[model samples]
Target: MADPQSSQLPEDELTVPRAPLNKMIKELLPNVRVANDARELILNCCTEFIQLVSSEANDICNKQAKKTISPEHALQALDSLGFGDYLQECKSVLEECKTVAAKKRKASTRLENLGIPEEELLRQQQELFEKARQEQAAIEQQEWLQLQAAQAAQAQQQGLHLQPGMQPTAATGGHFQPYQVAEGIPQHGAVPSLNQPSSGAGQLPTESASNQQIPPS
Candidate 1:
């Protein structure tokens, strides 16, 4: 029997061997027996499914500009690529996997900061993982609460800035106050007598010669 804890084979050698897959099928359907050819077909199908899932996961990593495919990417790919019909059924398991992966990453970072040797860190992995998990959860919760508070404050400021008639222009077509011209300024097409051209098209009449009364200068 293969040692379950042994390091996985390199990607190049990671073919889906038939025995384990067949064992799983049997466990699921103990009373049903597959014929030799049918068993081969099932094995092929299993290999194809794995290939599809791996390709989808790799695509997800590429989308995120990541060189390595992580568990989060895999989960997102599974959900987005229509393979997550069973997602609700396995939601708890997937959440636990995410938590574990996050804790591991946090632990590794913390140990590195403390100048712990990589090998020595393994001895206290559990303790470090628990500490990291707590810290990550607390940080995330705090940030979430801060974000909510900031949004609420912004919304309150917006409300205060708005007068009674204020509303989104998109939601309710904007209202325009009557366009009031300044006291001395004319409306759009109005011509003020002071600015009107004199009898000679290109020249202004002398101030004393004009019909209107002029104030003493």
Candidate 2:
């Protein structure tokens, strides 16, 4: 028989956590309360049991000229170590693990399982990318057109509010220029020149006006 103390790892080097050990102890004894020392001893025993099983599994693997100890070797080690009563439960757990692993493998290869060739899948992906790019470009173009329309509307609104005689000019640094009056056109509110004759000022008195004046005398 191996020394129990020799198989025990140091507290600092313990792989099994105390919290899970405590929970398991509570679950197994439900209403019964366990002491701290009893919990520590159970934790150490669990770790030692794992080390013993692993060593036996490794020996069984080496006897078969294998470099790695597989699940089968572990089951065989349990039986050889007089723990044959756990064999059925361990097998059931092993089967559950295998089922989960199979599902993961299947999920990882779903695309390949679809039966589509790699080249076809790549071509379809490229087509989808091209369609997305075209849609984005069209959206950008529509936004640009809407922006141009808004600017044009703003310019027209501003033009309607301008003074009648003012016109926009590029030469005046984006300012308005007053409309220039043409020569010979009379300006509003200007005084007439005294030296310039009016339309009837140069004409003599009419004949009828001269005859009427002699009669009155």
The model with the greatest TM-score is 2
Q: Write the per-residue lDDT of candidate 2 for residues 82-192, one digit (tens) a residue.
A: 999999999999999999999999877997789898899899999999999999999999999999999988887767457667877889776677878785455565677
Q: lDDT of all the models against the reference?
A: 0.73, 0.82
Q: What value does the lDDT take at residue 166 in candidate 2?
A: 81
For 110-153, candidate 1 gives per-residue lDDT tens digits of 87799977777686897899999999999999999999999989
The prediction achieving the highest lDDT against the true structure is 2
Per-residue error for 180 in candidate 1, Å, reads 99
Candidate 1 error regions (>4 Å): 1-14, 95-217
